[model samples]
Target: MKKSIIYSLIIFLFVLLAGCEKDEPMGYKGRPGVYFNGNEFSYSFAENPWKDIDTVLLPILLTGDLEDYDRKVKAIVVSDSTTATGDMYELLEGTIKAGEETGYVPVVVNSVEELEKSVVRVRVQIVENEYFKELDLVYPACNFTFTAQIIKPYNWSQLEYFFGPYSTGWWKFIMEKLGRTSLPYWDMWSPIPNPDESKYNMSYYEMSNIQQMIRLELADYNKHSTTGPMKHDDGEYAGKEIVVPAPW
Candidate 1:
């Protein structure tokens, strides 16, 4: 009889442990959280002729499991620190779509003559809500700047191989020759392809004539010389001859 009781107790304890294990399911049990991709970004409209509206897409990251339904991720514009008037920019609420861990906050800028005259600043903060719990991140509240200045492109480092060296004068010349304001690029390591870059990126094969044209233009400038053969007037290549490598 004592052995029977001991066996029954052992069964009861096993069932209780099994129930406890079932209570703690397999997937994430943490609270949903989100944060900005980075702290700052800057852009210029110096060569952009977007006289109506343009968008600057900023990325956001999520923690915890993705939901089956779309979730709202809000960015509040900090007007006190922003220099762009309400009329100059609109902050679009970001979204982490169903089953997605990433999203974008679309900051819309109204291209007016004002943006071409001076630098415009906009700041934003990511706020937590019921959908997303308060994360320790000092997220979003990111810095954005728009200006008339023709700052060097961010991808200039990788493009250094193609364009030789950087100089503002040469940069402008290259852009004019390329007949485009922005040179979009794709990272070899990106997990998914960026649609814009896939569609618009200039192929190396297409650059043969363009490179020849640049040399021709520089030669023409020297041929009609007021100043000697064109040397880069600014940047690291300043005082050095302006040259874009002939296509291979």
Candidate 2:
């Protein structure tokens, strides 16, 4: 009889707790949101001079409960970052259409003649609205660097340490000396185990030798140069002398 009574009390407590839980209100309130998904970007007209403008589509994330209606992701170029507006670039509205989750913000960058001498930059950011909210993120901003100079050559990364900064005139000079349409390049897998690429591939030592040749040529050219030190004819390094460092 005592055990039965104890079991009845336990059942009653469970029922009472269930009733309380049913009557209580929620303590936390929440809403659906969207987030910034932009990344660092840099472009150069050196690769494609004929193209006057380029559009970079930055991605954004939609969050919370999925709805069956179109939504807009608002973008802002927060003034804290080097914000470029007007002719430099144009930011378009991002959209997540009905029944769809992915969206993008389009930025149209206009080419400027001045870009041949310097780079223009703009930092884009997003804001929260009735449809979406910002996610907590460190380094929430993505930086962009736009220029007309040639992007660093893929093969010249290691050699660049000795070669100072890249210069359009300097690179052209190397090609002229080598009498090749394209300079040799190599990665871990190439020209070693693979013998087919031997004609086009170059070793670090070979690349170093090429650097020495350019240095010696530049030194000789400068010694006899009556027009003064040979400076770059065009590009971001224009008016700057082409200085190739000695072999390490």
Candidate 3:
């Protein structure tokens, strides 16, 4: 009878151990939630409204405890008919630090021209991760949508219709002279000019060309400013025989 009781006790212990192991959390187990701080983010160039933007950093937050080791979270910019791969914007996949809840993903604007054509929409989401998961019951899932607008500095029709043939040098001359005071506007166009030159992706020439275009357009506006007795108008006043106060 004692032997029978001992055998039963051993069987019970084995079942209990098996149950515990089955219920135990795995090495990567845990509800790690990911989300963006805001639903939408927008930006425009201040200096030259037509100029392309450099980069936009989207803030991401993770909730719950992270794994003991750092893990890479997969992020993807959903492409649609309007926003396709290698189009106006590019996808940004970033990592979440170990034991940290804050991270940032960079959504790079590919073309200033495309932004000017229309409002570009970039849809990004925190996709499935072996280490993390989307928060349940969240509206729209763990996704963020951003709209970027590129405002044209000058009316294209007016620039071409009113102004005669203009060269790039003429454009550069005005930008250097006028763009200096419009620093606040220009600062928005790029975080830093030519941020990475080692990648052989220097944009000095492209940026210079864009700046010149804006300057030329502005100069045309100044040249065509209509003067009336009602109010005094500001002119380019840069080597003009009739100098007037600029209406900044």
Candidate 4:
């Protein structure tokens, strides 16, 4: 009876070990430490860029209607983060289609660190559809602004830091550089010493510098999204336009 009991315990232990190993993949990284909107994101880029690494750094935004589906809209946003400067992120925005009122948005970021060099990139895209017929009205021309804010862990604190050093005369120096403004304050992100001081007072040079950086980053999107001229409706319903029934 003692021998039988020992053999049974050993079998149970072996079965438990095997069951645990079988459920897990070969090389799981476990849970990530940090999370965005409650979803954990791995900083490592296990999958390499399928094309030239530079191609991934460019900002891109694309929007177009589906050929056959009048009620569907498609949008694509892409950005590359493997550049020399340690900044990576992108955002795409445009009008949504009218029909089912369904849409999707995607955000992507890539991080790379080799020796002393580091790079981070972010990209975001939103797709949406709306049913105009349900409202018993024609599709009105509307503009929706979609914005994606890409924040690199390192540079994320720069804006605050620039404003943090208020005593060293750096603020005045920055104001001179940026052409300091007392009204509309300055950049929305710029910190203010007090709220009662409704106007923003800071270096215009610094504000301009930040603005320039933003513009340069976004310029890439316009260049990459188009491959060639697309077929657009001239006036009447051509192959591109599908007129929906008035009463449906």
Which candidate has the top score in lDDT? Answer: 1
lDDT for each residue of candidate 2 in 1-248, tens digit (9 for 90 to 100): 99999999999999999998977643212455555454565566664567799775555555555678988877777566764547777778877778765566667778877777777677877676667654454334556667676654433544464565676677667667777534545544432221124433667677777778778888888899899888877767788877776566
Candidate 1 has a TM-score of 0.67
Report the number of backbone clashes for model 1. Answer: 2
Q: Which 10 consecutive positions of candidate 4 have the poorest summed lDDT? A: 31-40
Off by over 4 Å in 3: 1-29, 46-53, 66-68, 81-85, 137-248
**What's the candidate order when arranged by decreasing lDDT?**
1, 2, 3, 4
Query: Which 10-residue span in candidate 3 carries the lowest summed lDDT?
Result: 154-163
How good is model 2 by TM-score? 0.48
lDDT of 1 by residue, 10-91 (tens): 9999999999999886544577778777677666675566546777776678888878999988778887888988888889
lDDT of 3 at 117: 45
lDDT of each: 0.73, 0.64, 0.49, 0.30
Top candidate by TM-score: 1
TM-score each candidate: 0.67, 0.48, 0.43, 0.21
The CA lDDT at 178 in model 1 is 70
The reply for model 4, stretches above 4 Å from the true place, is 26-75, 78-123, 126-154, 158-248
lDDT of 4 by residue, 169-211 (tens): 3323333444532112334453322211232244547545554
Clashing pairs in 2: none
